[model samples]
Target: MSKVVLVTGASSGIGKAIATFLSEKGYKVYGTSRNPKNIEDFNFKLIALDVLNIETITTAIASIIKLEGKIDILVNNAGIGVTGPIEETPTDEMRNAFNTNFFGAIDVIKTVLPHMRKQKSGLIINTTSIAGYMGLPFRGIYSSSKGALELVTEAIRMEVKRYGIDLVNVAPGDFATDIISRRYHTPLFDDSVYKENYKANLDLMDAHVDTGKNPIEMAEKVYKIIHTKNPKIHYKVGGFLEKFSIVLKRILPDTWFEKLLMNHYKL
Candidate 1:
């Protein structure tokens, strides 16, 4: 029997690529989005799901359980990026980022745990980012949310080990996703105060994202992790810069790393 997999945020980018790749691998796949209408691929079943909506999440998972009978893998990939200085960012905007990136993922895991626990077998993959490991300028909110997700995945992995379920975190350094184009910049702050600072950093981020790895590359890494007999707690995917960033984070002094980032982006 083919393994059953459910992926959220499947409308485009890495989520879409992962859904397509998994389906092609013969897994019984269900891809979800905020609206079923946004789903263009007819290859996999489209389910309406907004991670912030608990009712919608519950309903979607219930329906999937009813139809598929079991879920072999759950990919928590639904998230939004918010860019702004921490002090300039509104509290509400930070809450919204957490709601989608952290709480929303927890909601899905809570809903699916019972099924996976009963089956005593399943894999949960959380789509985190390199930002989770190290904070970046103008990405405080996004980084905080992903950092929270990283911790949640770690805790869940250890807790669910006895239940025969696995939790894995996939932290892509900088993928060529529409996340940058679709990013929400909170304007609640005094733009005039940090306009130049914000613009400089945001521009650099946009440029880096444009030249990042293809979403298909990330999807392939995800596919491999899912099929591994014993996947690691965390997997990093990206270019040489990504690996270097991780190494720098480990070996460099805090002030030095900060200087490096500021100097590199001319921020």
Candidate 2:
């Protein structure tokens, strides 16, 4: 029997790639997105889903369950990014980020866990980011949301271990996704306060994202993990820069790390 997999945020980027790749791998895959009309004749089924809407999530899961009978894998890949200084960011923006990045994942997980618990065998992969580990300037809001997701994944892993379920967190460093290209609704900052510094920081983030890894690379990593017999709790995917960042955080003192980041970003 083919393993059944459900992936969220399947319209594009890593999520879409994962859905396509997994379907090609012979898994009975179902991909969800807010706009499902664009997907047609794909290897997997595309269902309309808005992570922020609990009703939509519940209905989608119910529909999938009716046909598949069992879900073997669930990938929480739906998320958004918000950039700017923490002080400058608005409360609503912070809430929106957390709603989609953290709460949305939680909502789907809660809906799927019951079936997985009954079956006693399943895998849940949460798409976190390197931002979850290291907070970057100008992107603190997005980073904080991912950081919350990291902790949530950790807790879920522990809770679900005894149920014969595997929970994995895929933390990709700066992937080349349309996320950066999309216009962000950032908070308006006071022009008089650190105007030049803020503009420079935003520019640096834009340039960094423009040169990040391809989304397919991240999708391939997700494909590999799904098929592994013994998957680790966390997997990091990226180039040398990602590894270097992790090492720097590990070996360097807090003050030194801050200095390095400041110099790197020219903040």
Candidate 3:
């Protein structure tokens, strides 16, 4: 029997890439979206699951278990991008970001843990971001949400080690995806002090995504992790410089690293 895999946020972008690849590779793949009913083009199974809604999360997982009898792998790939100055961004929106990106992933993991524990074997791969490694200018909230998930994976992986359940984080750099269109962007008020700098940074961010690596790179990375006997706690996928930036953060002083990022973003 093929392994059952659940991938959230699979309606497009990196999630879609991972789901489609896994399906083609012979895993029983169930991809999810906020409105799976309308997503008709996917090559694998698509299901309705809104990460923010616990009911949907439970319902979807139950449905998959009923059909497949077990969830061998879970790719927690659902998340949204949130960008704006710390002062200018609405606190409510920031809360929403955390609710979806951080709390939401935890809810899904919590829902799945019991079944995995019963089975005595399971793997969970979380889709985080390269930005999660640091506080990026104007993208602080997005960074924090993903960064929180990264740390949580580290802590929980050990907690559940006895259960034979494995959890790992896959942090991807900017990918050519429609996330910019889907993400929350705080409106720029004409009188706001951040308006000018925010606008410039927004363009820079967009351009990076517009020219980013193909999403398939992430899919490949996830596939490798799934098959590994003892996967590492963290894995990163991206261009040379993007992956190297994490190393730079480790070796360089705090001020030096801050200067490097500022220079990259032209801040």
- Candidate with best lDDT: 3
Clashes of 1: 0
Better of 2 and 3 by lDDT: 3
Sum up the clashes in candidate 3. 0
Candidate 2 per-residue lDDT over residues 38-126, each given as its tens digit: 56656789999899999999999999889989999999999988876777777888899999999999999999999999999999999
**Model 1 clash pairs?**
none
Name the better of 1 and 3 by TM-score.
3
C-alpha RMSD in Å of predicted model 1 compared with the true structure: 1.6
The residue-by-residue lDDT of candidate 3 on 1-267, one tens digit each, is 999999999999999999999999999999999987655587899999999999999999999999989999999999999999999899999999999999999999999999999999999999999999999999999999999999999999999999999999999998999999899999988999988888999999999999999999999999999889999999999999999999999999999999999888877
| lDDT of every predicted structure (CA atoms) | 0.88, 0.86, 0.95
- Residue 4 accuracy (lDDT) in model 1: 90
For model 2, the stretches where C-alpha displacement exceeds 4 angstroms are 181-192
Off by over 4 Å in 1: 38-40, 188-191
Top candidate when judged by TM-score against the true structure: 3
- TM-score: model 3 vs. ground truth: 0.98
Ranking by lDDT: 3, 1, 2
- lDDT: which is higher, 1 or 2? 1
How badly does each model clash, as a count of residue pairs? 0, 0, 0
